[model samples]
Target: MRKNLRVAAYAICVRDDRILLARSPAADGTPEWVLPGGGMEHGEDPYDTVVREVEEETGYHVEVTALLGVNSLRRTFPGRLLRRPTDHHGVRLLYEARIVGGDLRNEVNGSTDLAAWQDLDAVTGLRRIPLVDAGLRLWRERPAGGRVQPP
Candidate 1:
């Protein structure tokens, strides 16, 4: 068996009641909307990670406005036929951000295939990763401890 951990940053960029989002390929190779951010590099700060990821994934330069909250998730899955089971843990840092520059464009040669603004009211009806819901809760509620029970 193997254990793996991922610590990544995500942004909640809301403007005019629409949130900026990126559609990345999910585990089953289908597209699902997510906040525009990803894992930090070896020596990068979480703040820098959010800015860089937002640009790479959404072609938008962002300024991280606030540390929204954190969401942690864990899963254990069977590996390929001959391999052992693996434990995966993901810790996501959600930040509130504002777009500073750049245009809306889909990521090229990256995990995400599309980038677009989705209306806040219609988000619940979309097929999305749980992080989207969790991040939004953190953004709206602004809990004192900056933590939420991810859905």
Candidate 2:
């Protein structure tokens, strides 16, 4: 079996009855909403990954409160991808976080199309990254222990 290990972090930031989300540009330049965060750097702690990503994407310092859960998925790179498909896999670490400080400004180097607070109820109508569903599922189970580990 071909196995690939990747590490990424994501933050679920809730503020004043709304969630802070970043709208990222899709492969074709269309906008798709997603939580603000990104891949872990060499030797960087996962916790710090989320913090650093949040700042880079939204210019906001965030305080991670707890681990939401881990999401592992098997996926193949698009055939047109220049990289090898054997190297494709997703290992994401999602966390629940709160904004600490800094003004909400989009980073010039960011891949985000837009950044703004969206009403919780209206999120269903927006296009979201796949991980958002997993993150929200874990968030809903906040006090119920956590995702049942595979037996």
Residue 146 CA displacement from its true place in model 1, Å: 0.5
Please write out the lDDT profile of model 1 over residues 45-127, one tens digit for every residue.
99999999999999999988999888998999898988889999999999999999999898999989999999999999998
Candidate 1 local Cα displacement, residue 1, angstroms: 1.9
Expressed as tens digits, the lDDT of each residue in 42-63 for candidate 2 is 9999999999999988889999
lDDT measured at residue 114 in model 1 versus the true structure, 0 to 100: 95
Model 2 spans > 4 angstroms off: 1-4, 81-83, 143-145, 148-151
Measured by TM-score, how close is model 2 to the native structure? 0.87
lDDT of 2: 0.82
Question: Candidate 1, after superposition: displacement of residue 108 in Å?
Answer: 0.4
In angstroms, how far off is 138's CA in candidate 2?
Answer: 1.0
Most accurate candidate by lDDT: 1
lDDT of 1: 0.92
